[model samples]
Structure formats: C-alpha cells, structure tokens
Target chain A: MTDTSLIDTSPQGSTRRSWTFTIGAIVVGLHLVIGLSTLFWTPYDPTAMSGGRLEMPSLAHVAGTDRLGRDLFTLIMIGSRIALIVGTGAIVIGGLIGIAIGLLAAFASRTLDDMLAAGLDILIAFPTLLLAMLIVASSDGASLWTAIVAIGIANSAIVARLTRILAKRVLRMDYITASRISGTSWIGVVAIHILPNIWPTLLVNLALQFGLAVIAEASLSYLGLGTPPPNASWGRLLQEAQGTVYTAPLGAIAPGIALVSLVIGVNLLADGLRDIADPTRRRRR
Target chain B: MSPLLGIESLTIQAGGKPLVSNVSFSVAPGERLGLIGESGSGKSLTALASIGLLPDGLQASGSVLLDGRQVVGARDRDLVPLRGTVAAVVFQEPLTALDPLMTIGRQVGIAVRRRAKRDGHPTDSITVMGEVLDLLDQVSLPQPQRIAEAWPHEVSGGQRQRAAIAMALACKPKLLIADEPTTALDVTTQAEILKLLGQLVRERNMALLFISHDLPVVAGAVDRVVVLRHGSIVEQGPVATVFGQPSHEYTQSLVAAARAFDDALEIAP
Candidate 1:
C-alpha cells in the first residue's frame, strides 16, 4: 500500500464525477422496468381502437385518438417498451458477439486484424438501416421475433469490429505487456487487465449503439418490418397515419415527434457520456 | 550447486535483426553479476530473452536453464508457472511495469500467494496479503494499509519503483534479473535502491543478474561486472578491477567515459 493511493475524503471526491454515471444507470434501469412491465400491463388492448376513427383527447382515451383511433399517449408508452427491448436486445446480442470476435481477432495478429478490419470496412461502408431492412424483409413477417433476430444479427457485425479494434489497441499497452510477462494466462490478461482498461471505451460504444438500435428498430417498424400490426408501436402508428396525413395531421406529427424526442434524449445522454467517461476529456476537466 | 540461471549460446532476433547473438552467462547462488553495456548493446535483450519476454515478433533461441532445467524455446503458456518461482525480472520502467489499474499491495500479494505453495500443500491466501503489507513497509511506503487500496497512478515515480521491487521479492525468486532498475530514479533514490537491493540479495542468498549502462550504478551494485560491446562481452572481472584497470580497449574507453561523466556531473552543481 502506498500513501498516494488513499482516496481523498473531501466532500467533492470521486462522487461528483460519478453522478452522471448514476443518472445514466437509472435511466437505463427505468427503460428496462418500463420495457418488462409491458409483458403484463397496458391501459387497454392497445390495438382494440374502439372500432372508431379520428377521436379527440378524452378521459376514456387520454392523449386523444389517432386516425386509426388508438390512444396516443398509451401507444407512446408501449412504444417505449418495444424500443427499449429491441434496442437492448440487439445491442446486447451484437455487443457480445462483437466483443468475442474482436478479442479473438485482435489477439491473433496483424494479418487477422487486417482481415477483420477489411471485412468491417465493407460492412461499415453500407448503411446499417438498409442492411437491417433487407434482412428483416427477407424473413417471414408473421414472426415479430424473427425481425428482431435479423436486425440483431445485422447489428452485431459493427460491434464486433469495434471491439476488435479496441482489443488490439489495449493489447499494445504496457499494462497488458506486463501482465503477459508476469505469466498471467492470455485469458486472464484479457479479462482482468485488457478488458478493465477498455471499459470506458466499451461503455461509450454501448451508449452509441443504444441510440442507433432505437432508430433502426423504428425504421424497421415504419417499413412494416417491425413489431406486428395491431401491436401498438410508434413506428406502427406512423405507418397507419400515412393514409390520414392530410386529415388529422396530428396522428402523423405525434409519433413523428415521439420518435425524434426519444432518439434525441438517448443521443444527448450518450453524447454527454462520451464527453464525461472519456479519460482524455476527463483529464481536461 | 547449480547456478540459478544458465544462458548458453542465446540469441534474440527482433524484426529480422539480431539484437543479441551467441551470448552466454550464469549466476551462482548468492552471487551478483553485472551485465554492463551501453544502449543497443544487447544486455537487456539477453536478460528478457532468458525469461521468454522479448515481445511479439521477437524470437529467442538456445538453451536457458533456470535451476539447471531447460526453458529456452518453451511455449509462453508453459512459462506461466515458472515466473517469480524460478526467476523474476524487474524491468527498466517500473512506472509502466506495474499495472495502473491495480493496487501495489494487491499486485505483490498475487505473486506472494502464488509462490507460497509448500511441498504441494494448500496455503491460506490472506496470510500472504499481510506479508505483502509488510513488504510495502519494507520498501518504505508510508501508510501501508490505505496505500494498498490505491491505484498505480496515485504513486510517485520513486515509490512506484520501490513497489515494483517489492513485487519481485514477493515470490522469493531464486534468480533476479533487474534491467537498470534505478535508471528512472533520482540520484538519492538510486543510491538508496542500490543499497537496499544489495542488502536483500545477501540476506535472501539469491542470484542477481544486474543489467545497467551506467558504470557508477553498476560499480556500487554487483560483485562482478561483465562488460558488453556489439552483442559480445569485452571484459569480465571483479567490479573494482574493471573500474580500476580494464584490459579490453572497449572497457578502458567505458571507464574513461564513466570518469569524465562523474567529473562533469560534480562541477554542474
């Protein structure tokens, strides 16, 4: 133990810096709670629609009614569930796959690194949405889970590429070399030394992926490649609103604003994290 | 009695270039041998190659006997069980040698527990951690308990170097290959570290292979100094003899350079 390692007990120690991380964690926690709650609860049969069209905001139907006569606010909340689930699902699925492939590729050598980087170069060159749509379209539409799986698989490629690059860079650092020479097994070196050091980078990437997943899920839903019809999603609402855009116009605008606002919140949150969690940026602060 | 480490006809190739070629050395028990050479003269490479840590794309070949058993050309995986047990190396840059993420106590405790195994019997791990705190105190680290919780980034350069030394000592290694351990320290700290290392070597009865470019530091440390030039030993004898009357032309030039360096540093203040 060295005296220098003692944490400062001043009221403004590491706690202040950890505040944003705490908030971000809560936001993500709420996302999971709200997302999981949908498996059990909802205001109404969201797709029931009361068999009527073009209704206004009322106690019976708060947040008014869409052109398809669905509850607006309830649908938005439910859409929140769908967005969070698909976003988390895709990012996690792709994130794990990416991390495994990346670590292995990076540990292999420059030849393997170049091969992976070249493959990712081609993947990154293509638009992510377009790839998701292509895969989702080719799959059977009756199965909503199938769409998520397709999109999730498509998204994993990018994450794997990113993790590979991060692993490669981390492997070159002195701590990693030292760990290796200390006779730590390669797996131990990767798990303890290499992974912990790159965690901030991984967290930032996770945030970025969460935002992208939300938009991608929305786009897929909007194209009728997302959560099945009568299954209340903002993307589905937007799709149904296309016919009455000239009429209520509110239906079109509501889901549109909802999509943009949610995406904006996630992006702002991710952007704030990107600035805060970054060691270089934190050092500047 | 077998020497702690035996390097016979060792060669190292880095990026298609021979860094150290056909080098041989040995460290008898309780004996300190200095491998003295200027930068790029391959002394450090030879030390690293003995421990199988020359980095990627660099290759080491020939017989390396630790405790008189062959380890040269051994796979990296096979080397894990031997580190700090048979041989431990203290690198040139201690600040980088210790992980920035781990505490000094934790780092030393790892090696201490790993090597405390006795006759293949089970051992209590926490007992070794307490011993690690003692070693931290041994290295003159103030506030041993709290210091054990802190990261490497929090320590000063000299303190970090001492902690690195503490880690090397944790496993009670038979052979210690220190590659210029005091190069990064202040003169006062350098002198203190040299004296402390010298004392520990005699107390533990361990073999020491000390590598350095500075003649004065080496002069104060090892019992016998082996001078190298262009990947070959140019002089080998007692440190006093080499410093007082060098036989090889290269060794004489090095002695002259060392004298001039001391004179220059003396007048600078």
Candidate 2:
C-alpha cells in the first residue's frame, strides 16, 4: 500500500531535483537541525552574561556578544528554535481549524453555505496581524503559547476560505458523484475523494501560510506582543539590537538575514510543490 | 407481482418548475430497457432520481421502488447502503467517473471489499486483489494485472469505461442503470461495450436500464424502448414496435436522426 513504485512518479519525482526545491530544503534543513540541537546544547549558555558587552566577532564568541554580554550565536540558535515552534504550532492549529470549517461550509446546505461565505468574507476583510494583536491583547500580554494561538487563529480565516473554495470545486467532480453512487459514506467520500483531490492546492496554500506564520510571529515579537522576556526570538533579537545599530550592525543584520532566509526557503518550496502538483503547469514548463 | 425496479408518476421540480413530470416505468428481472432522448429531455434525471442522487435544490415527488424498497424520500443512510448492491450505475464520462488519484486496483478493491462485507466474506488484501483482478478480467481488459496497477489516467478511455463497468458490477447488482455509458468511446469501442453489457446482463440474469440518445444503439441492446421529449415520455413499447413503427413525432425524429447518422457513416471514405 505504501509502495512508491506504484505511484505515478513522472512529475513529483523530479521536484526534489529542482533548484528552488533543493535550495529551500537545504536552508530549512539547516534551520531545523540548528534549532533542534539547541535543545541539548549551544556554543555557550544562551542566557549567561559571561562575555564582554558589545564585543566584536572573535574566537571566544564568533557572532559576538549582546548588550547583556550573552552569546549572540546562542541567542540566534534559540531564536531559530522559537521560530520553528511558532511556525509549526501555528500552522498545525490554523490548518486543522481552517480545513474543518471549510469542509463544513462546503458540505452545508445552501442557506448555511451562504451564511458561512458571508462570515468568511467578513473575517478575511479583517487583517490577520490586527486580529492577532487583538487576540494577544485580550489574552493579557504576550507569551510563547499565546502568540502562537493568536497567530494560528488569525491565519485560520484565510485557510478556511481557500479550503471552502477548493472543496466546493472537488465536490462538483463526477468521481465524487460516482463515489456517492457506489455507497461510500459521506465521511468516506470526503476522506477518499474530496480530500485527496483538493490536497495539492491546499498544500501549496498551507506552505505559503507557513511562511506568513513565521513572519507574523516575528512581527508580533517586534511589537512586544510575542515571547515575553527570558526567551529570545529572532524578532525580539531584532528589537533588542535596534538601539545599538551603529555600534553593532551585525546584531540587526544577523537575525534579519535569518528571518529572510527562512521565509525565502518556504516560498521557494511552495513554488516547487505547486509546479509538481499541477502536472499541466509542469508540462508547460 | 412488482417489478425488480419501478418508478410511478415521478415528477422532478427545480425552483418551482417541473423538469420531469409524471414519468413512470419499470424493469423486471433479466429485462433490457432503453431510455432514449435528446439532451435536456429528462432521460438522465429519471435514472438519477431512481438512484437518489438528484442534485441539490432539485426535488422529486413520486414513488421509486427498487427491489421492492421505496427509494424516493428515503434517508441517505437508507439509500447509501442500498445503492451499488441493489442498483448500480455506469456514468457516461468514464474519465471523470473514476478517481484520478487512485489506482484502478484500489478503486475496484473498494467495491469488492464493500460487497465482501455485505456478504460476510473474508476481505483480506490478497482476496481483495484477486477479486479486483477477476473483475478486470471479467470486463475483458487486456493484461488484467497491469491494468489493475494502472491509474485511471494511465489507461485509455475505453479501458477506463471497462474499469468503471467492472466496479459497477463488483457488487453483482440486481439492476444496472447505464446512463450513456458508451457515448465517450469510439464507434468500435462503443459497439464492443454494448455487446459486453448485453452478454454480462444475460449471464448474470440482471435487469438493465440502458439510457442513450442513439436509437440504433438502443435497438442493438434493449428489448424495450422508452422515448422522452421535453420532460415527458412520448412513446414507449417493445423495441420492435417503437423502432419499426414509431408513433409519436419525437420518436420518429429520434429514429430518423439515428438513421441519418448511420447513412452518413456508411458514405464516409
């Protein structure tokens, strides 16, 4: 059942060799490895203030020390971990909630479908960051979990809208009708036919959402609405580095590069997956 | 005695307008009935109504008795399990009828497994695979083993249609409703599929409700014919009486169209 040889491997098999996909995988892999390794060890303790404050890059501290005299490299490593957590957590919550709501809307009767459409329209009109801010504020200041939940909820509206449209299109297919005629239960029809048909498009959308989630977490942290003190996020590191920009430009540059690299990796991956999933597009290319 | 499948005074309304009004028909065991009409003539709607698969907002008010069971107004839970086993359908477009993402084996295996479960038979993977291969073989597909492993898109249109037919017959239904099943195939393939269906229905002693717009095609396969025009049954009787001497204007015109197509084909280089 899990045989790869049984699959139609012409288009998807080549996707891994595409430059964008390969590069994206490399960058994302590096981030994940660094982030996970931080669970056990970093070059120096992330919170310890042993190095001289505002030190330049040197053998003892390769990326140099921060204003608190803690290792900048260690802080960035922990920051990557935070980014991974928020990115994974927010996407899981958003994708699940959004896909479920979308399926409900697609399966609902005409009147209820209209109501859900209208409600989704209203939600989509509300900017995600603004909604996240409101949620965070309502939850009484930022923490790691609160920021993740807020971002997740905010991101869910977009995913729900996309899922509703994709699922509706899938439900209209003749195979879906045939599946129903074959006595497949509604849930079985959804699981076997509807979900698989809509998955490629939804996956591409979710990948794009992952990049946005990382950026949203960073923005929230920058605004002092994410991962409150004692933990370093890439966004928080940027915030802490802003005061000493001229003296230590690497402080701002390092986290900025890291943030941009991760987002780029995700976007490239989405592009590659989109090409592979849509065979017509892949053929044209 | 009640027929194997029956419909009486079936009226389908969409947005307060009747699409199919006051239509009635029935098929007994081993009967081959043809439903012939032009597009939008409610020929397909009647079949869809029988299967309880009418689209949303389209309401049907009447009696549909399948194997002595009331299908019209039956809950989906009741209709769902009754479908495929009681009365299976072969849709016109084979490409869209089969799931593109799944292998032909997997799709056929699902139907086989459902039938197995209903019959209280063992449903191990090997048994399912053997059943799937047997179904593919029953449809006269070349290389049943390779065909089972192939995806729907990997097979030709005719093969796909055969695969669809195999899946439909997996449950060994009492009545098989084929709605324009061969419309998408080539002339030769169409004839072969019609012959295959005729042979299978005879061998299994299953009732067949064969729907098509072609009169000659209907003549070739069915024992009786029902002509529909603008949501009404124009004329219906034994195929010999209807085709040999069509009474209604609609039936005569349909027969004329079919004759003209045949004449044109004969004249082609």
Candidate 1 C-alpha error for residue B147, in Å: 0.9
* Poorest lDDT segment (10 consecutive residues) of candidate 1 chain A: A1-10
What does DockQ give for each predicted structure? 0.41, 0.51
What tens-digit string does per-residue lDDT give for candidate 2 at B157-204?
Answer: 898999999999997899999999999999999999999999999999
- Candidates in order, TM-scores: namely 0.88, 0.94
* Cα lDDT tens digits for candidate 1, B1-269: 77778888888887767777788878888899999999989997788777777767888887888776677788777887776676777777866877665667778776666666633534566787788889888777777776676667665777777788788877678887788988988889888888888888888887899999999888888899888888877778899898888999999999899889889989996
Top-scoring candidate (TM-score): 2
Winning model by DockQ: 2
Q: What overall lDDT goes with each candidate model?
A: 0.74, 0.88
For each candidate, give the interface RMSD after superposing the true interface residues on Cα.
3.8, 4.2
For each candidate, give the TM-score of chain B.
Answer: 0.92, 0.97
TM-score of chain B of 1: 0.92
